[model samples]
Target chain A: MNLRRKKLWMTVTLAVLAAAVILIPAPALAANPIERFVMVEASQYAFTPATLHANPGDTVTIELHSADVAHGIYVEGYGVSAEAQPGQPVAFTFVVTESGVFRLRCSITCGALHPFMLGRLTVGPNWTLARAAALAGLAVLAAPLAVRRETA
Target chain B: MNRVSLLQIPWLKAALKNRWPQFTISALLMAGFVFAIVAGLVGTPVGSRNFGIIAVWIAWWAILILAVVPVTGRGWCSVCPIPMAGDFLQRRSLLGPNGGRTRGLNLRLPKLFRNIWWQNAAFALMAIFSAAILTNPRVTALALIIMLVAAIGMSAVFERRSFCKSVCPVGGFIGLYSQVAPLELRVADAAACASCASKACYNGSEAGYGCPWGTFPAGLTRNPACGLCLECLRSCPNDNIVLNLRPFAADLEKPAARLDEAFKAFLMLGAALVYAAVFLGPWGNLKVAALAAGTWPWLGYAAAFLLICLALLPGLFWVAVRLAKRMAPAKPHTARRHDFAQAAAALVPLGLAFWAAFSLSFVFANGSYLLNVLSDPLGWGWDLFGTAGAVWSPLYGSWTVAVQVGVLALGAFGAARVAQRAGARGGLHPLPVSGYSLALTVVMMGLLL
Candidate 1:
């Protein structure tokens, strides 16, 4: 390959790798779909149904309730939040257009394990996992190539 | 090795020469420290609202990770209140020179506990309970008070700053990561140090006391042990002591890596990974197991934590080293153990970066509480600053992932470069070592990002 072509290819490859690294997270998107309600219970350092699944364009209404003290749900990447006092259900709805794994954490100062209170939400066809794997592969392959290039 | 000596600057020299500035900063920190302990004991149980938790875990941690350790090596140690209390009690005066007389027993630190092994163990013990400690105001206060008492007790029974040098859990990692800090303290002229008959930097002088952490400034090549107390700067009659502003990771080029130090790097990287998984990862059962202390699940969790930190990560790293050895063009006289040690040292920069990246999520996401808790220290409906009712808002939100990736990449590249250097020093090929580091970097990126 010519020097210019080689440089172009290298730039393209690096751009793709960068994209793969940053592809795991996304904000909520506008989509019309049947709304599905998810009833989630937050206890001491845990959330019921720790893993929730949804289709790409599905609207998710999460009714968050604290089994113990006051708690709040802060969904990662969606910018959706709700506060739930004990026995009081707080409903938050958002359209899930991001096809990736996101975390829902207790936002309130709940207890000693407040920081650890977490749950996972997986949108269908999780591209984040595939992109992460691709990133890893790119690292493994590119490391040797860079080393050789330096030595050369 | 090129350095810009701070003492060369007239204003900086004048400022450092005076004890009042250092004393004032130390006193302020001491007051804050006392307030944290009091707030933890008597304040609200809520971690976010409590001043102790918000200030110590959120605000102080943010500064420590994002500013202090990266920019200044052991700068926090210079003004640390923990050792201030011990030093004051031992010297019998805050500003006066020890005059070759320490009030404490002044017994030597145990020969077996001389190296950083005790520190590593203490850090591991703290890591095990870190989840609880980070969120509980009472627990956090108790831990600080215990350390304070321990520091005082150690000063009374043992020698100077033994708690900091040999026992403090937080100090261990601070010391480890301080190697990467840009600022360093050293004697400017080696010949001057050699010619001087009175090594007042190590011993005491009329101007200042001896090195509190037992470090002789002349032989200082690294920032790991030297608690930058600035006593050496004051005590040196030859004026040999120089604080230099330099590049980061200047001390990572060890001729021979100590096993304890290498293991410290491993522990730091491993613990960062584990903490990321438990605190940030989408796993509820793991968090539950981590929280339930003394239970069967908790024991299992503890075992797994220890295994990952002590065995699995080190074992994987050893395999990487072995593979590097096999792939590299072998040098006839080189010892495998020595090469292994060198390879581990190369990971120090990456380890520090891993910590920084992990800490970003911690400090940024939860850091907003600093405002709320500052205004209402005890969460007792007292809005001193009118910002007590401030809403909890995480800054930069999802952009943190990108920042973390960038930081990790920087660290990974640094580690690769260091590995290449080590490879050249040992007459080996750099490819495999760099490859191993890249693999580890990808793993960290996957975990955090």
Candidate 2:
């Protein structure tokens, strides 16, 4: 194959692989939502604040940081995962519509306890649209403060 | 019977030569990897953990061992330590003392018996044991120890590459599949080889070892016994040795010469077939119990299975060899063993398809539980880590099956092309109908799986 063709094929391959690893469905909601500014600490095998809960139609932007080592946060159902390194936080946003609790697990084998490490989020009956709107305002305002602290 | 010659592909030729060092290093690097796996099995707890990691490991091993190794030919063998261990133990002097003379207690064996059957036997032995312990920590440990012992034992007796050429399942795998690998090492100038005299490549030297597999470098034109060791490359004064970057599956052929290589290919096909039957077949329950029980009766049954899988199949190959001889166009009485060997090459693709079918179910059956297991083990609160919504994800299985089927199809097509090319040289007609049937078989396997 020629150089151009090789590059084109390689790009195509990478794109496909990326799609396989990262494709997920958007959350279903009834307009009003819970907005949560969440921080997740990932390690070699486990992630802290592993279980996350929010009302129906809640939106979450998780600021993920690694405490000890490299870990991949792969959510199989959602098809979203982020690579977490020590002290470096990654951002990922997702909304869950299913009212039941969803299980979460580390995709990477980080340490000895990798097998036992797990957490889950319990979505409750108290979820409402008005409260979610208020939470969204807090989230927009809070991100700037976090960025300012980061710069400082 | 790959009838094609890929020598005309110049870019491939250059790419092969340029990438030699990387492949050489990678070969040796793989030995270290085997060591790490052994170490992990020995030191880590014997408990079963998450299934996802197991799936990944299994998939990685399959891709690397079955698909990758076989296609690349003696590329892996060049650096495989299984042979090196035997060479070291058997050869007293590491640096070929007495000017690389073949003068010592470790005498070279007869040329006729230096085929891949012995190695096939060894590989089969491992497969029997692997039935249960392939996934287990203790079994993997025992398996590694056995390999170490084999290396030590073979080196004590054989002159060079006794374990690698004669034994080692992984070696057999690579040798068989390597016919399909795009990269190959070969002679730069056949004319140079024809004219040259020292024969330093086949015979030893003070500088480096000879072709341990007993391949006379001057005579070799294809990639069967050539270990990609580059010893001959350096030893050759003719400047004839060079690695070829060629179309994959270029060497699948029906030969009139190189009898041992023909047998080795058959042995490889047989191994692939048996591996599928044992690993993927419905009899897995009995296979598992037979090993873990560890009684004499169980051992006997397991041994019987091994015999049927490895030895019986090779025996059938020899029979096929005889049958293939009659099928040859011109000569029936003196049909070459090489022809039989080339036909054996067709077995690779069929076996590959079987493996893909077997592994696909695990993608759906076992994947979700692994994702679920992580939350409790390391106390990660993330719900997919513990997420209830993550349960019953079936795409992982379907995607894996698709990938495997693709690999299988490619392998089948390549094998058929090479077989057809080789068969044509012997004046045999191409088996396009048979090829189509095999292709359909592979497709059906994916759809069914």
Q: Best candidate, TM-score-wise?
A: 1
Off by over 4 Å in 1: A1-36, A54-57, A85-88, A97-101, A122-152, B332-335, B427-429
What DockQ does candidate 1 have relative to the true complex? 0.33
Instruction: Considering the true interface contacts (CA pairs under 8 Å between chains A and B), give the fraction that model 1 also has.
Output: 0.32
lDDT of 1 by residue, B1-449 (tens): 56888889989888887899999998999899999999999999988889999889888888887789888868888888888878888899989796757987889999987888888998888788877788888989999999899889999988888989988887887887888888899898888988888888888889889899998888888898799888888889988899998866777655356778777878888888888888877677888788777889888888888898889877877787777777777664677777777788667778877888888876777777888987999989999988998987777355776566666766776677667767766765666666666777777766665
Q: After superposition, how far is residue B125 of candidate 1 from its true place, in Å?
A: 1.2
Report the Cα lDDT for residue B217, model 2: 66
Tens digits of per-residue lDDT for model 2, B351-407 = 554444445533343445445434422122344444423543334523554455454
What level of docking quality does candidate 2 show? incorrect
Per-model DockQ: 0.33, 0.02
Provide the RMSD of all predictions against the true structure, rounded to 1 decimal: 3.8, 16.4
* Per-residue C-alpha lDDT of model 2 across residues A5-89, encoded as one tens digit per residue: 7655655664465344334333454557868887877653345675666766678676778787666565534566666777677
